[model samples]
Target chain A: MNAVKAIFLKELRVEFRNKQMINSYLILSLMIIASFRFAFSIIDFSITELASPILWISFFFGGMFSLSPIYKREIEQGTKEGLLLTPISPSSIYFGKLFANLFIIFCLELFILLLFFVFFPVNIPDLFSLLCIIVISTIGITALGNLISAISSNLSQSEVMLPVLLVPVLLFTVIMSSVSVTSNVFAGANIFDVLDEVRLILAFDVVFIAVGYLLIDYILEE
Target chain B: MLKNKLRILVSILAIIFILISVYFALIYTPPHEIMGDVQRIFYFHVASAWISYLAFGVTFFAGVMYLKSKDFKWDNIAFSSAEIGILFCTLGIITGSLWARPIWGVFWRWEDIKLFITFVLWLIFIAYLALRANAKSRTSKANLSAVFGIIGLICIPFSFGANRIWQQYHPTILVSSEGSLQPSMALSLIISVIAFTFLYIYILLVRVDIEKMKEEIDKLKQKVGG
Candidate 1:
């Protein structure tokens, strides 16, 4: 627990200390959300109906931006050896990074959601359900993102490789369930109506987190 | 020498079965009652789909074994299987599209779960192959491919079950709720699958041998440089 907290706090401290990553995520997400505004005219399509996909797309990009550097910086600075040399379990390292990425991504997601409400004529019919969906889906996204980022960080072309590796894996798992459920939430469906998607996202979150936790050792192998 | 002879035997057997299967599909089986002869594509389409799925399953298993055992041989098997799987998958999609253009009046159906899942599966493995190509060292390639391969395999079930979470067009008539395939059609399909499976094995053997030779060449060059 202390190791997770220390690592988590260290990750946050690093991000806040520099703020370059957060700024890039902010600009990228804002651009994505702003471009989406022009793509869907309110005259042709209802923004409320389209809000779910728009928000998730922005979140996906933001999540990717945040995830890409999870281990790259460690490798670049040679802190990877320092971290590995610590008397800590690898699962601790994974979960700590996972949580930090989750926190950063969830914040960006909420920011994007707020922008959607302001920039587009969209509504959250059920705010609680929407938040639940965002949190659960973001967990799933961050879990898989951490694993893929770890894998990509080892490669030379980490930037291009991250999304190419991530998008397909996310397509059927996190993106599908979250977009579907978020749409239902936007459409004012009862919570029970979106239970299946919620369950699917939750199952994915559990599976990927466990897989990432177990697989971190192999991925971190020298 | 014996291995070479066995490979020749398998290649010959595969060619013969493929010819026989084509004959059975085209001449022996009666055309569909409503769709007519275009339905003959079903035999090859379904068989290719099955083989592609089988090939990917082998890739996943071999990937796991490679990770567990750290054997480059298993990595070779995984890579060869994935390459063949992609080929058959492309063939399956093309054949399916051709059939759909005639019957469904479209080359692709957006709402079909199987179509969506299969496309995603293709993209996932393509990404896997891309990662393998990009990796620098032998261990890096094996480790990364194994991890991605496992993740790709996991994504498949979720992709297939995406329909369950929402309404999707599930037009799975090739194997219906009741096992209702005509015996003759089934026979033709079985022969195609066997022929393709043999073809997969033969190609895999050749590819692995080539990979081994390449590694040998790399070693010799390194020794000469040293």
Candidate 2:
């Protein structure tokens, strides 16, 4: 537990100091918002309906882009080995990395969602439900991303391979997130409407996290 | 020697079965009232999907075998199976698109759960093969690939369920709310299933044998060098 916190805080500090992850995420989100705004200005469609899908798209691709630096940076500095040699369990290391990545992506997602709402006239009937969906879907994304990024960091083409390996597996998360958000936007945040999507995301997150934890020790074995 | 003989036997039988299946698919199976000629593609398309599933199942089994035995042979089998699975899955997706063009009036739609999931499956295995190619050591490559093979197999169910849960338009193909298949199409599908399973087994055996021969040649080369 202490090791998990230590690693988690260590990663958070590194991420904060470097600011690469947050900078890229913010830039990409702004670009997506700008593109959509430009396109919508020409074509007359209700921005409210499009808000959820656009927000999810930004988050999904942005989260994917953020994965390279998470593990690749550690591997490049040879810090991964040093961290592994510590008394921390591999699962703790896995979870800590996962949690940190999730936090970064979740924060990015929330910011994008806020930006989308400001730009568009989307009204959330239930803020709590939307937050739940966001957190659950983000877990699913980061859990799988953590595992694949760990694998990719060791590969020659970590940059390209992470997305190539991840996008497919994480498609489920992306689809579910899109569906949940879309339903919330169009249908007034009915719990029943988004229940299946939320459940699927939650179930997938749990399963992948468990699998990633069990396999991380072997994956990190020298 | 016996194994070689058996391989030959299987190959011959597979060839015969495939020829018979194609004949049945083209000439014997009556055209559907709605889908017409395009429906014929379903025989091959569905067969390829079956073959893909069978290949992945072998991959999953061989993955476990490699982990348990730590033998290079099982790893070879797993790799060969994944290769075969990817081929069949590709064929499946292409045929499905061809079928969809006439029926759905669109060749590809991301909303279709099955099509999307199948594409993802294809990409996952392709990544697995890429990982294998880039690894530095043989043992490390095999071990890593085996782990990936198992993890990818485990992911299939979630992928499938996710698609289904989203209420997408992709045909479930295997069970219906009302009940079983629609008789004629079901029979034709079953025959195609058998034919494709035979094809899968034949291809797998040939690939495994080729891998074994390559290993033997590598051993000979090492012996000469030493």
Candidate 3:
């Protein structure tokens, strides 16, 4: 408990002590969202129907792109070795990174969600359900992202490699379920009607996190 | 060498099976009542799908073994099997889409759970290969991809079941033993499956050997540098 909290605190301190990452991420996401506005400018359909996919696409990719450096600093400065030398269980390290990723992504995604509402507003029939979708999907995304970034952090080209590896495997289930719930809500479906997608996202989060937890030791093998 | 002789035997055997299977498929098997020559694709299509699953099964097994024994040999087998699995999986998807277009009036069916699962499964293996490519060290590549290989195997059932969670009817051909297929068609299907399985084995052997030779060259390079 103490080790996990300490590591978690350290991560947060590193994250906020320098606001460079968050500031850049905020700008990057807004730029992508603006470009999307231009890209869909010529489409004939109501932009409201396009809102869910756009929101999820920008936030998901933005969250993913922001992750290219999650472990780079640790790896480059040999800080990961220092942490490993401590008596903290590797699973705790996994949890610390997982939580940090989940928090940072949620913040970034919330920023994009607010921006999206302004550009192409859709009445989210159930705010609670939409929140559920965001929270669960973020967990699933970061769970997989942490492992992928960990895998790529030691490589020569971490930036290009993470997405090529991460997108295909995680994108299908996460995007499909997230889009399902969000679009259903946009179309004024009741929260009960969206339970199936919610369940799928929940189940995906559990399975993904559990798998990452169990496999982290193997991935970080000496 | 004895190994060379065995390779010759296996190669000859695979060739013969493929020829006989092709003959049985096109000539010996009678055409379907509702559909004509196009149903012939079913033999190789279903067979390739089955063999692709088999190749992935070998990969899953090799992954488990590598994690247990930490042997580079098992990693080689896993890597080769995944490559072969992706090839056959792609063939399966193309052939399946071609079949769907003629009969179902759509090139792809989102409602068909099997089709969806096969597409996702194809994506998973492609990602597995991409992950393998990104790893810098030989051991790390093997270890990381082995972990992913096991995870990918677990996703097989989930991807198959993913659509079933919404709608039940997925149009499975596995339940075809109830006299739906004629005796001649059954025989052709069996022969096609056998041929493809042998083809899988032959390719696996050649691929693993190539991996070994590459490793040998790498070691020789290191020795010269050292």
User: What is the per-residue lDDT of model 2 for residues B1-226, given as tens digits with 9 covering 90 to 100?
Assistant: 9988888887887788788778878888777777777788888999998788778888878877887788999998999999999999999999998988877777887766678678877888998898888776777677777777777877777777766655542343432212234576777777878878877888888999899899899999999999
TM-score ranking of the models: 1, 3, 2
TM-score of chain A of each: 0.96, 0.89, 0.95
List candidate 3 segments past 4 Å from native. Answer: B1-9, B161-180
Tens digits of per-residue lDDT, candidate 3, A1-222, equal 788687778887888777877798899889888988888778767764677778888987889876777677788878888988888888888888778877788888999988887777666767776777788778877887787787778666778878876766666666655765677677776667867667776777788789888888888765
Best by lDDT: 1
Model number with the top TM-score: 1
DockQ metric, candidate 3: 0.37
Error of 2 at A154 (Å): 1.4
TM-score of 3: 0.91
User: For all candidates listed, what's the TM-score of chain B alone?
Assistant: 0.91, 0.89, 0.93
Per model, kept true contacts as a fraction are 0.52, 0.30, 0.39
lDDT of 2 by residue, A51-102 (tens): 6667676777777777778777887898888887787789998888887887
- What lDDT does the true structure give each of the candidates? 0.85, 0.77, 0.80
Q: Write the per-residue lDDT of candidate 1 for residues B1-226, one digit (tens) a residue.
A: 9999989998998899899989999999988776788989988998888878888999999999998999999999999889988999999999999988878778997567777877887899899999998887899999999999999998777766565554522244342212246889889989988888888888988988888899899999999999
Residue A215's C-alpha lDDT in candidate 2? 78
* Decreasing DockQ order of the candidates: 1, 2, 3
DockQ winner, 1 or 2? 1
